[model samples]
Target: MNSSKPERRKTREVRIGSTAIGAENPVAVQSMTKTLTTDIEATIAQISRLENCGCNIVRVAVPTKKDTEAFAKIAAQVNVPLVADIHFSAQRAIEAIEAGASKIRINPGNMRSWQELDEVIACAKVNKISMRLGINEASIRNLKEDTPSRERTGLMFEEMSEYVREFEKRGFCEIVLSAKSVDVNRTIEINRKFSEGFDYPIHIGLTHSGLPEDGIVPSAAAVGSLLSEGIGDTVRISLAGKPENEIITAQDILASFGLYEKKTPRIVVCPTCGRCMIDVLSLAREIKQAVQEIQKPLKIAVMGCIVNGPGEAADADLAVCAGSGKGYIYRGGKKLAVVPEAELLAEFSKQINLLVAE
Candidate 1:
């Protein structure tokens, strides 16, 4: 049989806290905290929430000395691995590692000079911590005020390769690499080019991907393309909204590609048409909320018309096909019973519970 799955890239395994990244491990989900890191209570609460929502790694910005001091307290309260995002200053990177950050992320090309780079690497080696060499088009120094688009991407790739080589030569191979650009195609191309040359795990995302609704589509397109090609070992769905929304969007993107295991009922609802009888939109919303706490992997279909509903949803584990003001429950394409509109939510929950019990 012919298969469409992308061939896996061979990479060395690196550990972030207790989570093992690269090698044969599943691609991990990552998110950054928007809260001020110095606010111990707020940062811890946000990190706890992200962990509950299936975030595998979390990054906190260490922009100042205060933030570096806060890492010790924040590290004590969170369960997932913590990475300190440092820019320009190698001293802050050393401070954060000493304070117990599991990893530190810096652009090796843009960070200080060779002496400072060695300082950062020495601290990381002594602490036994991992690092991410993040190089982006926006951070590349003095390219041109108006360089051509094509030339800009090429420069970003060249700069990233230099950093990758530097990290490798220093015996600091526990690194993750990212080459981000606002342009989706450029982001994909740079990572693909780097994958061909190195075995370091690539952290993939399109930077500054605007608001939730608009940002999600482009971010998903970029991430999905790379993941489909087996080019990403970790991913972050960057958005301009609440960080929790990023977690939800990331899960949805993975689910769409069938990469994430369906732990909850996968609801398949059709767009209502003129021939629709029941309030399909409202019913689908109600059913989703009603089964929000269910953790079983079941497929549920909600269709507008009865004629094609059951047939179309035959593959679903359970389904609801609407008539005038009523609906029929289907179990594997066979009708089990008629259900009133008011009781649809309850009925679906009851069936899910039965499945869970078994």
Candidate 2:
């Protein structure tokens, strides 16, 4: 596999609180709070959990005046940059920023009046906060107004261009941009155009990605491909589940592209076939469970045959190859033990602990 890192697109740097995106910065991971904004304690607790799990930034929906008030309290209690998800109401957008949002996401197409957008932009400028010109295809009001499904990306790009012009006219360059769609192809297409058309950092995600089981594959496909192309500055997986799960998914996607800063161990196991002579699946599962508390970014492999086992073992820090009733354990490509099948896992665990200790 050609795992060469993608050449990142050049973009102006934008900071949301202390976290920076674009202009060669590592791609940041973001997730939203699923709790109601008015429930200040619950929102705070959820944000804390997200921060603990390595989310770079957290967004909260602030659609009501009371939510903005609660948002202020939530912001006061947390250290992660908070983004206010605003829609339709420029007043809410302004209030959220005033209440201490590091950034606000709004769509100009959703706002009827230029004057209201001006107000939101002006408030953002005064607060010295960043703004994201988020364009969602499903939320575009004129979806059926002579626009074919095939042409939606064009419409989205045009809408984004118009908003960019308006922001630039107001001398507001502290901006991040995003265009999302539930359809994987559209999501990929619109973001590609965003990258080509603007130097602003792009937030990439598949919007309304269904429940975890349904969302993981499409989200991985859309988000992973964009990052691999160097088109995104930040990522949010947007699964309809725990927000922390979204953060984990985002981190995994970034790690696959070698764009994530934090490190965690990686485990590789061969897909056993007719040539296999041991229960590779059960042993691999045991190793995975055993390594939950290990933090070193060690590469571990479990192979069931000679076809690719030795080659894979050469690349791993610790590996085991099984044949019939026994297994061969290797450390740094050198044989360490030949143990019976029943003792393979125990020996593997000891080696893992020793490697981690080192």
Q: Judging by lDDT against the true structure, name the best candidate.
A: 2
* Model 2 lDDT tens row, 1-358: 1246789999999999999999978888899999999999999999999999999999999999999999999999999999999989999998899999999988888897999988998899899999998988977655785677668988888888988998999999999999999888889999999888999999999999999989999999999888878899989998887999998888877777777644566788999899998889999999989988876777889999877888888888899998779999999899899999999999999999888888
> 11-71 in candidate 1: lDDT tens per residue?
7888888888889887888999999999999999999999988999999999899999998
Error of 1 at 172 (Å): 1.4
State which candidate has the highest TM-score: 2
Number of clashes in model 2?
0
Pull out the clashing pairs in model 2. Answer: none
Model 2 — which ten-residue stretch has the worst lDDT? 256-265
Tell me how many clashing residue pairs each candidate has: 0, 0
TM-score of each: 0.93, 0.96
- Off-target runs (Cα >4 Å) in candidate 2 are 1-3
In model 2, the Cα lDDT at residue 70 comes to 97
Give the lowest summed-lDDT range of ten residues in model 1. Answer: 1-10
